[model samples]
Target: MHPRPPCRSTHTFTIAGSRVAYDRWSGPGRPVLLLHALLFDRTQWWPLAADLAASCTVVAPDLPGHGESPMWTGCTPEQVAGVLARLVESLGLRRAPVVVGHATSAPLATAFADHFAVHGVVTVDEPVDLAGSGPAAVVAASGVDRVPERFRSFAEPREDPGLVAAYRSWLDRPSTLRPVPHARHPADDLNPPRFTPLSDPESLASRIQYLL
Candidate 1:
């Protein structure tokens, strides 16, 4: 297991009656805000946070009801986006720092870019469409109460068992946010298609070289 990064000071701000918690890993460059998917807390970004913080100030926040943040009274995606917009404005991030989202957070990232000013946006394994026939279809087909189970059969054991194990552990945790009522099952919110293998380390290294 990787060592946990030292806990940073948390700042709380109110949005629509809910108090949101965020921590900053200060560095001498532009800011980058990291957002995690549903059912995950801010700590899920620890591995990437440390690496990114080496070059830039990194801010990771627990979205409305996730992590230690307060529960959100409203459940629509727009409402969630509003809270994020407020958080960004509160911090006075005027340079339009990069907003990165993972899993279900891809939509939120796009929403951020669409509704707010952001320099760049990155999404990892987020569904392209929330109401599409992808994950939601699987949920409807399986008739399962929880949606995450549908993807279980697709998870292959990688060389690094620890990483795979860690992901599995996260899947087992209960979500802090009030579940979206659109899907009957929890997993239904996830994109049914697996993340592309192009995101693997080897492929990513090659892509980075090309970008350079």
Candidate 2:
């Protein structure tokens, strides 16, 4: 599914005092909200969004301080989730959105589902229990350099030291999530096919469609 980049419209909206910059690609199905991992910005979801955009209205937002968004003042996961919920509400999707969160955004995704209206949620390469383990652990868990040389170039600038340090308290904070009615797609299996969202977005997009 290496297709051309779909048309997108960049937007800025304020929710809970945090002004967020998001990219929206129109579609007619249920909307899909794409949340990138730590360090990376909304561009990380560009390809995946394009694939999903044929059937889903895809919305990718620069998390707080990343990309074009301003710094986020919220500290706790619940607070951030609340802001995200408000942001999604502003989209006025015809149906509830299916939120796809990658890596560190997992907790925030679940938190959003815990208290908001979501059709479903998908988490890619989620680093479960890696929070508060420090930087070396973060790198080891991320395996960012193992990707194709071409993608590595895109993955580099995202590893900013200042941005990483600024979000330290984010990983350490106690996650405030309540278990939702969740049923795993085969993609959630222990021995499923190996794929990074960037490396195999079409397959991931298939999994998202199956989940829906």
Candidate 3:
């Protein structure tokens, strides 16, 4: 078994006029940034972050408007991506660290790879697509239109195939798509899946290692 690392502490950074709060477990080698799904906060990545800290420094931030980070306007994948890009630089990472995004935040992961100089990206429970399907398609895809407007705003991209193509085009870097076993459901926004990191840290960590 890997040695149990110490508990992480929350740190704050300012980006785009917002206070981004994150948890950091200091380790060695390349850093890893964990971005959580909508509604949930950075604490969702605690299990995965702890396991990865055995090999690398892990940073999991509460995306704007999630957890302690507050936002005054509607959130978009591009806006969130910008926040993450700034956070990495604020941490003094000389190179782009490995980025991991889960659920609806998968697009955010791709956005990082598109805009930043990242080593690689790992997307869990979803493929790398900018989701040009728009709000209606997102509801249909999730099998539920009951989600709040805020969730829809960020999770569902505009109905612009050109934008989707643009995002797909920038994926010149390495990326891995790992689906959670038996957790692929349509109503992801209404009913999020069980915490994979906490429930299956070993498998998740192994996949992340594969990406690294």
Candidate 4:
């Protein structure tokens, strides 16, 4: 069995007058930015983050108006994506992050990739609407997939107004993300091979590795 994955610690950064709070677990390589579903906080990703920490840095941000993060006067996918871009920029990345958005956040992931230099994008449980979001290069993680029974509630596509307002831009916009000429999942899989993330998290984690 593997040792326990690193625990998360909260930190905040100000971007354009808004305070963004995030949970971070230091590791190596490109940081993995974990965006939880609208109804849940960053802690929802704790189990998966721990498993991923050993492989690379894991960062989970509280969606604005949810968890420790306060609501932004204007919550748009581009706005939130900017905040996330700043967060990723703060990581001092050599390459772009593999943005993972869950449920409704999937569109937001595309928004991020649309505006930033992302290694790739991964939508968990939620299929990202690529029409208005993302790099053209898209592929299924051949071996990784799905949700855990308990996480079903969190995976539901439900969120409060603030989240809706923020995500609407992503849903409505036209595709701005540049098509990646080529993209695919990385060969590496989570170690220990037994402990899975939230919804068979290992499978999802393997997909995230595709970009890493």
The C-alpha TM-scores of every prediction are: 0.59, 0.82, 0.66, 0.71
Q: What lDDT would each prediction earn against the true structure?
A: 0.51, 0.69, 0.60, 0.63
Question: Model 3: which ten-residue window has the lowest total lDDT?
Answer: 175-184
TM-score of candidate 1 versus the correct structure, residues matched by position: 0.59
lDDT of 1 by residue, 159-190 (tens): 23332232332333322332221111244356
Ranking by lDDT: 2, 4, 3, 1
Lowest lDDT 10-residue stretch of candidate 1: 175-184
**How do all the candidates rank in terms of TM-score, highest first?**
2, 4, 3, 1
Question: What TM-score number comes out for model 3?
Answer: 0.66
Please write out the lDDT profile of model 2 over residues 137-193, one tens digit for every residue. 554444454556545544443556666676776565443433553433444535322
43-152, model 4: which lDDT tens digit per residue? 66776777787778888998788788988887777788998898888877666777777644666777788788887776644433433332211112111124455554
Query: For model 4, what is the alpha-carbon lDDT of residue 30?
Result: 82
Better of 1 and 4 by lDDT: 4
Q: Quick one: best lDDT, which candidate?
A: 2
* Candidate that would win on TM-score: 2
| lDDT of candidate model 2 versus the reference | 0.69
- Candidate 2, run of 10 with poorest lDDT: 186-195
Which portions of model 3 show Cα errors greater than 4 Å?
1-7, 72-74, 127-195
